[model samples]
Target chain A: MSKTVIKVENLFKEYHLGNIGYGTLREDLSTWWAKVRGKEDPNSLIGHTKTITNKILESHFLALNDVSFEIKEGEAVGIVGKNGAGKSTLLKLLSRITYPTSGSIKVRGRISSLLEVGTGFHPELTGRENIYLNGAILGMKKYEIDKKIDEIIDFSGIEKFIDTPVKRYSSGMYVRLAFAVAAHLESDILILDEVLAVGDAEFQKKCLGKMDDVTRNQGRTILFVSHNMSAVQNLCSKGILLEKGAIQTQGSIDEIFETYNLNTHHQQCIKLDERIDRTGNGQLKFTNIQLINANNQIINSVLPNEKITIRVHFRINKVININNVKINICIDNFYGARIAVISTDNDVNFTTNFNNDFISRGYIDFTFPKINIIPGNYTIVLYSTVNNELSDWIKNDALTFSINEFDYYESGKTSANGHGYIFLDYKIK
Target chain B: MDNDEKWDLIIKPAGSLNFNLKELLHYKFLMYLFVKRDFVTYYKQTILGPLWYIIQPLLTTLVFTVIFGNIAKIPTDGIPTTVFYLIGITFWGLFSESMSSTSNIFVTNAQIFGKVYFPRLTVPIARITSNYIKFFIQLVLFFGFYFYFLFFTQYMKPNLYLLFVPLICIQFSIIAFGIGIIISSLTTKYRDLQFVVTFGVQLWMYATPVIYPLSNIPSKWLWVFIINPIAYPMELLKYAFTGQGIVNFTYLGISFGTSILLLIVGLFNFNKVEKDFMDRV
Candidate 1:
């Protein structure tokens, strides 16, 4: 077995909920008085319990609680978790961006992280200058940067504008250059946090290939944190699943992802209003979502050719006037790739009558006569917008449903599984 | 892969005060690049470019000449008003600019610091080095007018005390850098310090002999000005060229001692804060 490159032991990070700076002098003096008397801090008593009542004081929260794990040399470990699950905090601790509140992490060799691209990039600097600047920030030596300057430029595919300032380059070109510089970094351990979430599909593919080469050929360890399941499965052999600031499971990528999916799927039918993981203005909220058959029977599985209607109920808490109110529903496969997007804006006859009066309660229904999706489990994302601006509700994986195999033409021939997530209509003459 | 081999790094809740010489040496190239970036990017967008470096001190000297020399009637001893004020403001500008920028290191570079890990000390060191280049330019401009005064007239005489010029420059930079990092670390939690630093540097100049001669102050109250660390270097510079200011061993010793103490405290605070500043910055 290879040597253990990283060993984390009983890490716990506590964070205050409100202001991070030193409080008023009065509070400081009181705390000092309490300390002098050998009593507990007066303010520390706040938020001691986890009940989360309206009147209760919730002063602090644990970002990472008693998390421990070890990574061996040449291992690609994927950290999977939802937001606020301590994934970034763990990475930050490992990267030395922040100190763990209580714990020790022993790491071997030099580690470099691409937590963000173009970290020190100056817009006024040319592409070549930024590459050197970013490279140095990632801990590259001047000679090393010089050695790989040509390769980095070629990899970014922006050699034509290498001398031009990055301010003039398009955002795509900018990200490409930034990623190219970071991709060329030579380190014993490379830590990445959602770097593949940017750029086009082609560049993303190139990055994945580069990552593969870096680990497989160069024999370096990797710690990857991302929500993209397929990318995690494809790149990582080991996986760690985190939940509510604790490690829930650790195993092979396939096993851990299965556990993650099972855990999330259990919460699929819960009230949308109870989910605190949503973003928006809070003026409107999604209350409930369901998929129903033509007979108005709620179903979790349906045949490929069967008609289904997705009903989304919402509640408005404020009076507002909005034109061009749009509701967008996206269907994504298990790998977190959007397979289809259906929006009310695409409907020619659709009209939103939300004028000066408040909409107390309403529901939007999207009916599909023929679900041409292949037999697979998929997730639905709900979004609302007013005047083409994002409204008070956006939910990810709001609902999950599976399409069962069926022969649309009634020829007794079923679509083959694992071919793709979408089935096309065809006829052989 | 050897079990007995030492790990490259070990992170814990509290970091040690022992300086990591190996890591700093390893990141020497990064320091060079940071200095290069600062030097290149500061003037990239400006229309006047490097010309601003010369113009800034010249203009400031003109303002000082008008206000202190013409209106306030502060004596420059035997030295010409332009040379005296130019020398004072030029060196003072170097120290003040470096101090202000260094004080903002963590807050201004939070984006880079949050994302990547390098020897955090490299940033302030690079700031000091880059500002040295700017100071060097202004120094040359000061010499340009100094030589013009020497050749075109006989009002000023160069002296052997000019040998101490290099020492004075290093002393000023060290003191500024030391105080700057200390302020930078404190500003991480007490952001109100950011507002204080700008006006503080401006007010600090009055305590130092930037606009007036050290002899102009009453002898008994000279200790008050001597308590300001910058006073020694300013007086030393004026004494070097025009031979008109105080140059004593006691004041230099005190100045040196204060600078070294401030540097130790600054580096200690900076080292402590760099590990977890992202949480609050």
Candidate 2:
């Protein structure tokens, strides 16, 4: 009878980058002592402190928070997630590259992982030698490698270049040889992380076939992670969706994939304010359901790095010459942090004639200069006042756009990082 | 497939220092391949290449003769200063090489650690073995000089105690790996210690009996030399070869016992690191 091969319970893991060079030994010892007693690390849940932009943030984020699942012998499981959704983090834990901050994982058979392409290949070694060397790294013995040497070479289809050093091989050749070695590993359970899509169409099909054989004939369990939805739905019996370090759902392949797709929609709206009542008195109301452009479209929904025009129109019923008025607009990101602001001066003192039969027909318009914000959600806020008294304030949650790709223009940027969120271009060169 | 056989390979990542020798034996071939990679890649891109293995001891011995024998006129316990320093440097370098190579095992191999899983200690264990090969190469050069001096020189003579050289080599291996594992485990989290250890070996050479004879250390602060386990082996080398220096039995026992303790503690921490060192690193 087949067995339940992989069992994982309440597995959790986290990582803090940049500031990791201290306190590792103390952490190692404490974790080691805890594991020996069959107890989880006390500090694993709290995790290490994270730092960003010279600010040490006290909030600890779980890269993989209390995730638990299992695969029966010969069962295939697929994991799907968007960026920063902890998909890779979970594979790392199951592969034992890092221990879980909490929980336990038990595998009752030999486990081999192709977590990254060419993981243990040395450039100095020959393709022939690297096949042996990498096979060893994958936990195959010299004699076991001897038996599969010809098969690995033939499957790779690079026998002509097999005697040359791997540094001389093209990237396609390198990945082919790497996948060949890992695919031939005889372990009872295999875990692959985004490695099936290697070389071209033929190579990927070959790798998929090898994985299929391992599961069907050898009764080996496979946990596969990939961005290809069709492959996940076709190859796996079970599916899991991870979102922001927590498990969103796990179920039948069709069920989890649908759930995964729905949760990954981009949220670009920045601010939640659509109406304004200044001075805490609900006296003056400004409700156009967010300021509209001349076409009456949602304003401020254009690209961040493009010139944008913001226009607001209003109506009045009082007979007054409102000559002391200014329109102020503030910008912010989706996470509720203010970035920039713009306002026209009150020097002009443009008069708005309000009479019993008067209808305000003009709109305030401002052209936003060279936009430099990255691709994310942002908000625009508008304010109107007369004679230094606040009359109306309105903030709108409009989805701001961002463009990708950096063509380096290194003529005069004081802070010339090769790539970052903002680009300061001074000249074409 | 029952629970009895499934219970094999118990990994106690924390607490005690015991290891599963049977599992290590099962993975012996993997160990051999790692050693091969280290030895080959190290000598890959050089002009003289593996010959540097023999050349290092030869060149260092000549420099020792010029500096200590010709300039400072330091006594070599009646042995040739060139031979004395060569052997001392060879043994002392073994300890330092193992320490620095393995001390950053977690940090230096973060890429491989992140991508795959093998026995975690295999790298350090392979490091010690490769250094042992280098030690053997230097030993051959030391014996070549030993034979030449005995036949040609009048002031110095070879002693029968030279047979104990193999035992001294083992002691040196134990000492090197003990210190290295401790440093390797610590440096996984505290990385700059790797830089400190690189030059730390250089500074430590001045404190050990590498360039100077053990007897030449001041009698006023004799206990200072006792902290370095290399001192006992160096003094033993002098006594066993040229029939000079004290071979204190008490000090030798302490050096041997301390090496075992350090290996245990170092392995203790190193095993804990194996679980998720790649994550933290």
Candidate 3:
């Protein structure tokens, strides 16, 4: 059995809010005076006299509270969470970038963190020189980087320009070189945070493959944080879900994702009129959205390549005596990547001089002959424009639905889930 | 001991003494790289390049010789005017430059510090090393003129006390780094120190006997200079080279003691603040 490589216990990180902390001479002097007099600190609630819960809430923000976990050697773990969910706070503490308010962390081997790429790259330095400098910053010895210089140059695929100053290289080349250096780092435990968000799609795929190779062939312990669920699923074997500074679930990747989707989308397909998280001139508003099948039946689930119609209802918030109204419904996957767009902007049935001058309430229908989406959850975002200006825009989960698996080709198997987000109708020939 | 040895690393809220000689040894290569970066980049795109290093001290010495020696008629205690001013300016340049740069270590390198982890102390160490290199170049220039005066003119003198010169240089480096890191730690929170650093170093130059002999100060005001840690090393450096200034072992011993004391306080505060500077900076 593999031994435990990382263990963290009861970690808590409390951050002081606003300018009331020790950023001035007066504050520092006051703190020193309080300590000298054996009195409670005037600026902080931590490590001092205990205060009530509400005062603590007002003065301090607990980024991570009572967090504990352990990982064994060669185990790849993915940390998943929304913004401000303490995911980054945990990573920062683990990497030793900052200290926790209370707790301890123990590690049995060397750990390298690629929290960002190209962190210390100097513009005037040549790419080769920068590689060495960046490697040193990440804790590599001189001889170690020297041994891998040629391999690093080869992996970045810009060998011809390796001697040129980094300022002369394109942004793409810069990122490629930075990522190449990080990917070649030899450590028992590697921590990465969305460093693959840059470069082109093909390069991103290459990075994912390299990460997979590291975990499988090299047997390195990896802690990866990313908003791209598909990438996380591809790289990590186990999953950790965090919500509001605490762990909500931890399990296999699939089970964690299932729990994550259910928890976040619990209020599915709510009344659009009540959504306050919207922006626009407020001339028009989206009231409801329904996904209807060919039989005119409402659906909460769908099959691949099925004929469907998305009907959107709207109400006029103000008198819109205008021309050239456009309505667009964006289809986004569960991870918030846009899969396709259904819009009235370029449809033959949409007239060029359309207007809602007198209509107080009405509905528009967009018919898709075959919606070739894969098996997963999706969110619809509604947007409308009047006279080339945004009249109303509603972001995030205007309507939520899931696609169920079906044998579209009669092959007794649906293409493996999450391999791709869309499928094309084609023949072998 | 065996239980503690099982883990390669342990992180906690508070650490002991905050000095890790072993970790500093491991990052020596990083320090070397930082020194190289500072030295090479200082003269990367200039017409004069490293020649400017030589020119800076020469120009300052010429101006001081004319202004203080010729016009103000400040006595050099029988030492030649140019040599007297040159040695003081060169030595002062090293301390002042290192102190100013090291004082800004956290504010300047916050980007790299926020993203990665290394011994933050290495930055200030590298800073002093690089400044010392520049000082060495200027020292060579001073020796050029000194040799000229020695071989061809009657204005030169040499003594066994000159051997103590290296000890004095080391003293200056330690004191500069000690005070620099202390100010850097305090500046992380109180930005008022930011404006005070450059102005204060200038005022500090007058407090020490850099431009004048220690004998020039009245006996009533001598206690003020005695309290300053840098005055001892400054006067010792002058006496070691020219043999025209006062030399007191007791004062030198006090300066050495003060430097070590300041260094301990600096390391403690710097190591404590580095872990959380990201939250404040």
Candidate 4:
């Protein structure tokens, strides 16, 4: 049976906020007393997100809080989080690059972390020299390196310039050498911090192949932290979701992703741009478009091909040719992946309703009537066009959005692969 | 212990002072490689190359003789002024140079430290070893000048007590290393220490017997000089080479004891600072 290679317990890390915590002696003493008594931290609850951010005056913040998890031998764990979610901090702590404010990490074997690419390599030194230096840094003796030098060079595939100084090498070459050394380090545990982001697609594929081999052949435990969700889902068997220095969930890949899918909350950010703003010098500028269902409440979720009302209210700022006024609408997923686009250019006829009061400031409405896409979290981006050409673009984060699985197929069945992706089907003879 | 425990001993944080001897022994190959890099790279692209080693002390000795021997008309304890100043500068050079370079270990190698982890002390150990190569060259020149004076002039007397000079050199190195690592930790925060060290090390030579004889210091100043500790080992080193030292067992004992104390303090501070310096530095 596989033994536990790593065990972490109640690991807590705190940071000093300096004078920004806004407390005099009495308040500070009380806070300190509360901290000692393990009460709710007074400052921890006050970090509410706000609009009109005034120059980001944060003195200190907890990069990582009490994070605790364990991995058995040869287990590959993927740490996934948005920006500022403390994924890198967890990796740094595991790598021993920095000490925790309060925590202990116990591991049964040696750990080698590839936190960044081209780390510990001197530009003035040759690839050969860097390999030896990196080997020593990774706790390998010269004889050990002597045996593996060729293998590392072969893996890195920069042999033409192996004797050349590293400064001359491209960033890709640098990461290749660095990753080669790190992968060959032979530690029982390998910690990676999105190091694959530095390499090209082919090299990333090679590295993934190498990582797969490491886990399968050597039975090494691997911990990976990455922002790429697709890559994480593909590479890791287990997934850990972090949200603002705390773990939201950890479980099997599909289960955690599903929970992540269910739990991510949306505090909608509404913005008025030229595409959706009524202040422009045109016939009509879309200022606001709120999605409504049978219930007038904010449509928090929806299914694909559902009959949803997209109420786009706009007003004219000035009178003009009213020539070719177009509203371009694009629906995008969380990773900025555009799912679909709807535009007035596809309309058969252009309608012009002109009024002097409406020319100065009046409202026009556009109803999508129906949305045909798979179930997903999405935002609508709007752009304004005049004379069949774009005059301005407006970005609405969540305009008439929140899609669900109501997009119908001819067969009336979801694709075997999935329903949420690009679908192209034709009957064969 | 079995293989599982042996792997843990090295990969784990060190718990006691006994050291992971087997791991260090395994890493000896790295140590040797580092030392070779240091020794070879010094003269790699220089004009005079290794000749600069011998040329450095010879010219300094000549310049000092002109300043203190002829101009200042200072006494050299009845020894030749050339030999007197040469020995003083030699000992002072080794001790002070080692101190100055070792002091900036972390500051000079901050890039390397931020990037990866190895035995951080390995750099200093390599640096001290590199300085010895230069020291050996200077030793030969000192001997060359001594023999020349022995054959050509009337000032000639050898001392067998010089056999113990290597031990004194080793002691001076350890003391320098201890002090160096300590200053290295501080320089990580106060980078001004790096700038201060060059001038500080140069000024330190004046307090020791670099330009003057040990006898020139008044007996009343003995207690103050004894407390410094570097003064005695350096002065003893000069005496070992030139046979003109005021060799006292009490002074030697005090300096040796002080060196041991400094070494302990240095290692303790160095270990304490390694964890968080990547943030501050």
Best by DockQ: 1
Per residue, candidate 3 scores C-alpha lDDT tens digits across A6-66 of: 8888888888776734454576688689889998767665665566467556767888888
**Candidate 3 clashing pairs, residues 3+ apart or interchain:** none
Pick by DockQ: 1 or 3, better one: 1
Worst 10 residues of 3 chain B by lDDT: B1-10
Instruction: Rate residue A65 of model 3 by lDDT.
Output: 81
Chain A agreement with the truth for model 3, given as TM-score: 0.72
Off by more than 4 A, model 1: A20-57, A269-287, A303-307, A313-332, A338-375, A381-397, A405-429, B1-5, B14-18, B45-48, B219-223
lDDT of 1 by residue, B84-120 (tens): 9898888998899989889988998887888888888
**DockQ of model 2, rounded to 2 decimals:** 0.40
- Each candidate's lDDT (Cα)? 0.84, 0.70, 0.84, 0.71
Any residue pairs clashing in model 4, and if so which?
A276-A286, A302-A404, A303-A404, A304-A404, A304-A405, A304-A406, A304-A407
True contacts kept of 1: 0.87
DockQ of all models, two decimals each: 0.69, 0.40, 0.42, 0.18
Q: Candidate 4 on A1-429: residue-level lDDT in tens? A: 687777665555444444423343455577678779977545432333444223222434567767788788898888987656788777766776665655567777877777665655666678999899778777776777899999999999999999998889998898888888876777788887776766777777888888878898899988888866667777789988887788889998778777655543332353453333222245456666677675655475765554566655665554455444676677767544577777666665544444344334434334444555555567676667766555555543536356554425657765443434543444779
Q: Candidate 1: what's its TM-score on chain B?
A: 0.95
CAPRI verdict on model 4?
incorrect
Please state the error at residue A129 of candidate 2 in Å: 0.9
Q: Candidate 3, after superposition: displacement of residue A285 in Å?
A: 14
TM-score of candidate 4 chain A against the true chain A: 0.60
